[model samples]
Target: MRPMLLATASVAVLTLVALSAPVRAADAPFNRISTFNVVENLPAGADPAKPTAAEIITYTEDGNTLIYSDSPGERIGFIDITDPAAPKAAGVVALDGEPTTTVVIGSKAYVGVNTSVSKDKPSGHLAVVDLATRKVEDKIDLGGQPDSIIKSPDGSYLAIAIENERDEEVNDGALPQLPAGNLTTFEVKDGRVVDASKKVIDLTGLAAIAPEDPEPEYVDINSRNEVVVTLQENNHIVVVDLPTGKILSHFSAGTVDLDKIDTKKDGVIDLSGSMKAVPREPDTVQWIDDNRFVIANEGDWKGGTRGFSIFDKTGKLLFESGTAPEHMAVRLGHYPEKRNKKGIEMEGAEVATFGDDRLIFVASERGSLVFVYRDKGPGAAPEFLQVLPGGVGPEGLMALPKRDLFVTAAETDNRKDGGIGSVVTVYQRQPGATAAYPTLLSVDGPDGLPIWWSALSGFAADAKDAGKLYAVTDSAYAQARILTIDATATPAKITAATVVTRDGEPAKGLDLEGIAVRPEGGFWVASEGNPEKKEKPTQNLLLRVGADGAIAEEIALPEAVAAQAGRFGFEGVAVVGTGADETVWIAVQREWKDDPKGFTKLLAYKPADKSWGVVRYPLDKAAKGWVGLSEVSPYKDGLIVIERDNQIGNDAVIKKLAYVSLKDVKPAPLGSEVTPPVLVKSEVKDLLPLLKATHGYVLDKVESFAIDAAGNAFIVTDNDGVDGTSGETQFMSLGKMN
Candidate 1:
């Protein structure tokens, strides 16, 4: 295992400077700008007072247009910016179910539609549309409400994020309602639907260590083929294996107990005989390599202390940067001249690396700055470089070989125009300088507004070629676009890109989450449906895009077997292929239902015939009731799905090593269990309760899960921490399931 790097005196100096800068206003000028707004408002009869559900916004690789959707509108919109200065409304597509999210591959776009418009229904669907034609080519009926959609790097599998809240209400009668969600896997072949499976590994055991309060939030797969998930509310990281969908390990990233903290001192307080720690919110996770990951430790949902924590691929305890890891400076004292109050000191690193001599980058989201550092050794303090300021909200950071550059999506309320988000900023390393600040370049959108608000998520570069860069944004539009950057370009502008629009119409009702590039010039994007609109849910859609910004093809999802009576969707995407051709893998999350035997779905797709297939594995039996599938990625010869068991009163478990063959895959037996061996069991544990009592019962629930390359899985809890009793927070793991 690699050693953790500590902060040095130089870091202290930088921290002081970071604490002195003022917060940038939302309307600050950027190099290049673009924006998109939901052109259409809520329907005439819709509730005007309700907050517009549309949140995420994203772009395609060709960078020509933008795609987004919204829950309140229950529709998807497309904006064509073949001209960055002026963007035109391409078109908007309506769906039978409430559309939540979308992902575009080639010519096909997959959308996660929520059919359960009310708490009584709680189901959804996945809509497959042809981008070139702008028509709903196919629709998969997912039994439960879905969350997010993802594809495997090989192009053989599809993963869905499923929520099964109804099961918890039914099984644990009269108990406090636990948010039920899991990860599902599906099989696809040549744009057709195929086999599907679900794994809901038990997590009842972890309850002893950390309380279950919030449900899972985000899930992903790392290079090592492991699944990692973030339990937002609970502040724990769950790790699982891919093939078997088993819980390999679990660890707490950070713990906080507001009740025990002295409001006057901002520190934990000791009770007569017990110690109380404040709860922290673990928002995001990024893999540095196959065996290492960096976690964004948002101290508390109330916006208290914030920092970053580093962990090995196995979820082991590593090093953590102090509070407020971003590069923004906080005011030291009250200023009489400005009549302003003093601000808290900012410290810690936002993101860090562990390869080729450790390094860390502290990104100040509000300040639009970054602080660089060189790690001396494991647990040894890192040496600070200099304070570098540029684009806004440098949330996502990517380090290229020899040369390191970070991408900033200048996402802010001011950058948004008529609901459309704008451009991405590129900060390149300056040549012949070790401490000089990187040069900033703007990757503009069609309307010249910053193409980012809260939508941008991940960034990837071709391993063989350093000149190519790909970034993804989550949008309400049916499709998520990829921004392809030419690293060789002097100013680093996006030259070309593809979007998730069809027949000049945008795929409405889809929430796109993550994207990955394939070796064959084709890339994949993940779509997650909206849980709030579950009555008429949508199926998970996987799209494939060729090198020239053209849609190559798309795969339609099949109905989930565990979905019994509701709808389903997907969240994350990953692909793994050999030779000239590759197989695509997708993760599916089944919607929550009232049934006790509910399960999630996972599927695979092949590009050869554009047909769909399923993994003939018995994952449902392993989960033993309703299971929520979160994420899936390529591992060994098969793929892995993060199976989160959401059954009430049961501890969540990480299921691993559930393997399936790529050849001769078929669709799942809807509402039936056929294949048996695919169901593999992993470490099971009860999740710690967020509060000792929520009214009368404890709060515990699993939300999202993901795995890294070395089989390390991270689980994110969804404990809101609103209650005072629950103190369990973040968790992680670095060991394999026995």
Candidate 2:
């Protein structure tokens, strides 16, 4: 007899095996397994230039098919999830209007289509799509714009949040901006809606503040035929008995006093700010049980408490995780610094019972992260299991307990913005599987708070400690800082941080891209320059800084070569020896005006004598975009460089580790007209496979490369500080490089 995975086996077969015995939840926790890009559904003749998104998602009765709302594409797309690890595109059902949410009942998908001509003239409908036919069979008028839709536990009713959302321009997003919103409901049987049973429930004058404008945001129901709705703009929660269409009880979602949070866009993650009495303008809510529920405080319109809360049936606060999620994000270097006003922006929540455990999943839109916790029950708080990187701006989540699967629908479409587009990421729970994300993180600082950091652009292993390493941030931060990482930790922790200072004040406007420890107790850093900025043209520099962060020296390109330097300057720096005999090598990202076509330079500098020399490095022919060098590091008898294409996502082609032996290599003088010999290169490894292993879009910047003290090679990608990118950083170690 074979004891096995049993993934595709029948339940009866599993029941027969379970009679022998089964393991506990301790074996398999939730972990991401795959990512599906929505662009694969771009229809025939459709402009590939346009964007598409996967907002709210739902699965079929058998959990083999996944349906998601695509607002930009004006359709509902499907995915074949028969094998959760390798999902395939199953086509799309075009809609007449923007899709807000999709819910599957039997073989039919009920999608809320927002047909609003304008905010003041709100209009929409519920389109019932026949999944097999791939067509919309019926449309039920919703009367107003709908945001979220939920079906009763017994499949007896469908509840919709008729959010006639207010225009923010009119009153700075204040409520009572009139044309108040409400709730709509209808009877459902066997997966088809009974149109005649529609009910428009009035939900006004329910909150103490802005009682006239009840902008319903999200809805969910209990097993007892009771529905809970969040009036986001008014900062209130209301429960209605679906059968009677009557408001049972209502109360304010309330405020919270927060501390140890970064409240400004200062480009640094210092947890010393505070928000007092900030209203919890919840966006998504889910019921854990008939008597308990959870709300994600998205802080739309006015308030965002920066966390999620659990409450009882009568609106009593059961648990408040104030600033806790944001703190956890800080610990993982996933905090979006520019979005400090609403740290992490908890926007989606899902609760499901898997095996003997009940799990609550909370998602952060701005942070692109999801926090998973195991519910301990009514009186106690949930236990944190792990944090998952859901694509960019994850707006909704679905938990399939029967299939042991959890899915996230990220609504961001950044193709037009030169970023990763919307994607539906798949995660599965299996015993003995390890959490795959956040390969590295930071520990608490002196204030007993997590060391907040992001936009890591460079990496170098500690010459002594096996798992200890150093990193630097890019221009995304105003103050140039160096962070120390302890990669030995399960999630690799950042033990400390130091701000790079020049003379006295923090180094300003530095686009630091590379760093190498100087063996003599300090470091040499490379700062990429931007010559086009209006303020002042910054020159690429090789800077030597003391162990305490004070600048010791700054070496610029020789005058003649500096005059012809383009925007793509030095990206990486590596030093080969000690003080007097040290030869510093700087890698130019791309060819400058003075260089040969399709070739970049490996410039050399001898600090012992202030001499400059340059050698050419062949560039790979990019299939679709420009290719350039990302990093330079001494490895064994030669130097290893990370060469990559500028394209992201599906357009990415080349991400390679190439090496150049230094045996007979000699750099030509910087301004010499004589052509220098280009180095003969050999492939060390193809980083493309490793980059795609994260189950995300192939990140464009494979910037940092280093071989640790234990001879293990490591690579880190730059997230562009979450600017236009998905804010997903990949830091992994490739064990033992020969």
Candidate 3:
């Protein structure tokens, strides 16, 4: 089992410990942060099989570890690491069948277990584990397979990801099995689990799935109590209501085509021939405010222009950053080479916000650096900022509020060094912050073989105080776990860390992808699904700890919906508010087949409303099935969904603008008017002349959408073109219906 390497980096030259770091203060630029590598491997008793599978790892508030099952390994690993730097082997646990993922609440941990890896028998079970005792406390046997899990913020209800299968025995005419995904809610009181309500969210009924493509990833929840999900095979994002489980709206975040860029443009580049936009990957989503979010685009296979899309609450298109726009500046050559100060530009910029200001900070993975820009303020033309060196393949970023610190995850290129990884650089802001420049205190990683093989996936911070930082990795072995460090701790030392597996057992799987922090403490982890399974589904796990730094509770998913035929999974998680009465929103990806009536589903859970049950909503229904649905965000009283549409025959397109309201979602008001079609007729000669004089296809792929409190929507298109030649992105007003 070659360990996968995850790396995250940043650049800063100064340090400020106070909450206020001089908003937009200008100062002289300083050198990038220094780098270091802290290597820690699993104990000798850990699995030695060298499994060729990926592992997902996460950390809890009390400092316990939560691990999910991944391919090549079909179990969950739980390790104790009250100490962030040194992790102790706790124990490994597995289900009677293949497990999807796990989530924790209070003192219980919920685990989704799939019984059959093959299509023959797709039944599964939801296993409940006691984190305090480190044992499988109970189990809920369910039909089909359970993909993912979600719990309300108040810990009242639990939602399970379920794929429904057709009643073949009753329909007996040799019809193909109609596989769909749905949500099942379980009530929680006094730490005990009880069944509540169940709703079948049928994706196949919404649209047809592309023949060769897989189902969408999972549905995500936003700040406004909305569910956002994607139609993977098709390129689209679906938005829904969390409280009522209703379908509100859907949109397309444009896709990208790497081949579209014409490096040798003898003439103007034509994107039509090269590539099409696809859906956003379910792995990346960041919350800007209660009503807005930014999504990351994977770009086309050929690697084209990729960036993020912004949207308002109510599923409307706002605006997107320019296509393949240069957001960072870098100095070439080695240090001391004064003449090498020239800068090079990078493509596909992803952004995150620090405060309530219009300036949004961006991280360019391809550029291997970070940049700052005015995302919404007046005359906001993104300006260049200091660049963090090394830390290639940056993905997700977390901002430390009071300490003025920022951390990012680095997904290392595995082909280079057998997939070993390292942490990216971390930087702190100084008091003398300015518009032209800013000071930073930096920390870098080691430069070697085994040290740079790991890749960082998700990030989170301590809610009460931003001084504690936590990050996870997407590695299989190499003790894939969560590392905890003090935000104000100088020299960037790993204070504590925890791995999923223990006792040298390979049954405990840990391929963690996304993570979020709760106000009370602890962390939530999402699994991307096992690569080995043809029907890849995702899962969620909750990890909680106490002030004593002990594993207080591990709440595994309770039983509700069973997995069936289609692929149902989860990606992102967010806690909308504070206090014990808060709500928890989870993202799920529901798959559809070639059937024209396929659709994607998103779900929400309110732990406080234990009896009210879990609510689900439909984002979009396609005549054709969608491929990958990645992320969701809450905006005002609604939600924004980011989806990647992978249609067959045509190039993939990304969907950006879409909305869903939480107030009142009644069966999508019947009798909605359909626009009349237009017809055009012209002579062949005239048509040829018009074609030669026109730009490529007017409609591009859209992947993700975000919304602000004022109802302004922002759409992002994945222009998968290189060298600014082929792909192009557009910014449009949502209300302008042409």
- What ranking of all candidate models by lDDT puts the best one first? 2, 1, 3
Ten residues in sequence with the least summed lDDT for candidate 2: 1-10
lDDT of each: 0.44, 0.85, 0.39
Best by lDDT: 2
Ranking by TM-score: 2, 1, 3
Write model 2 residue lDDT over 399-487, tens digit each, in one string: 99988899999999888867788999999887787777777777667887877677888888889989888999888888899998877
Ranking 1 against 2 by TM-score, winner? 2
Off by more than 4 A, model 2:
1-27
TM-score of each: 0.41, 0.95, 0.40
- Who wins the TM-score comparison? 2
Candidate 1 deviant stretches above 4 angstroms:
1-54, 57-66, 77-91, 95-101, 114-121, 141-145, 163-176, 188-214, 256-276, 299-305, 326-738
After TM-score superposition, what is the CA distance of residue 155 in candidate 1 from its true location, in Å?
Answer: 3.4
- Candidate 3 residue spans exceeding 4 A from truth: 1-49, 52-58, 62-72, 75-102, 112-116, 119-125, 140-178, 182-193, 207-214, 256-287, 299-305, 321-738
lDDT of 3 at 368: 45
Clashes of 2: 8
lDDT of 3 at 588: 54
